[model samples]
Target: MSESIGPVLRVIGCAEADLPAGPARQVAELEAAVWPGSSPGHDPALTPRTMLLVDGAGTVAAALSLLYKPVPLAGRTYRAAGLSSVVARPELRGRGLGGRLVAAARAELAADPAVDLALFSCDRPLAAFYEAAGFEVLPGTVLVGGTPEEPLATDHPGFDKVVLAAFFTDGPGRDRAAFTGVRVPLHPGDTDRLW
Candidate 1:
């Protein structure tokens, strides 16, 4: 459960496994509509959680996934969480529901003592949306996903992506600058190729 963010909209969350049947189905349908055959949004190995934004009628308005895992950046490993698979119902796209969900998730991560930072990548065009939700674009930083053996990077040809992040705690040796302009070896593995 979450505090009401609007008169008619509230944010609720659960571990991916704990999501109730109704919202689960809505989330599945929404994912299929947006990403025809993409992998599941929550990677169990990453301790994933799902956040749903719902109207007062108890209908899903928007949804997103959060994955917590150790992320390596600039030679140090930090506890991190990444936002993934964000989608607002087609009819509700222009009303800022997705932005609300993302901001709520950012707040949740910031409040967690275990999370050192939040990191994720979005298409170049959507960078501003994520920025409006309180994430700072890390210019020229590449997020490398997949395993080191078969990595995928934001900087790869034909992929216009930008890394966005919010540091909740000081990183190794209390150095935040270590993350700037460097490649983050996120490597959430094959299932989430670029989470």
Candidate 2:
């Protein structure tokens, strides 16, 4: 890989039938490093499409997944593209590779006419990182993940979370003040913690 500024970036769709095994395996390795164990769906990258930052030699430097699902909000269902499983190689931490990849995901979502907004949650310490990448911290927003049988909301006791969001289209995001100081339901389902 180059020691220069940027690394190769690619956005892969879940239905990418031709994704080569090499990159796929590299993605799996990167995911495993961050998620050492298994869960319902394990990782969002394992579901919909993915965005990857591959080194010059084709090794995954940082990665995240873009999964879209309809969530009932404000008495309407909105098409949201949620970012999940974002990770950067441990050795490359301070290089801003993760930020670059995050920014790329935002750009992709912002440009998509079909996408309503870009939403996700991160720990309080990481809130600044996502904000630098253009995601606004939703003051009191809570994303609900988990199965319908046992739902999990970010605002639940003993859990500290910060919702990072970017409103792209006209409907839901038109009123910016609404998102602040209010709790909103994302409802990504039980398969993912907070896709």
Candidate 1 wrong stretches, greater than 4 Å = 170-175
lDDT of 1 by residue, 1-195 (tens): 576989899999999999888899889999998999865556689888999999887799999999988876556678989999999999889998999999999999998999999999989999999999999988778888988999999999999999998999854335457777888888998888887
**C-alpha RMSD of each candidate structure in angstroms:** 1.7, 3.7
The lDDT of each candidate is: 0.88, 0.72
For 1-195, candidate 2 gives per-residue lDDT tens digits of: 112335354433343233467777777777777778643133443346666777567787887777877766665666788888888988889988889888878887888888888878888899999999999988887777776667788888978899888988675455445556666666566567667
How does candidate 1 score on lDDT?
0.88
Model 2 has an lDDT value of 0.72
TM-score for each predicted model, relative to the true structure: 0.94, 0.84
Against the correct fold, how does model 2 do in TM-score?
Answer: 0.84
What is the RMSD of candidate 2?
A: 3.7
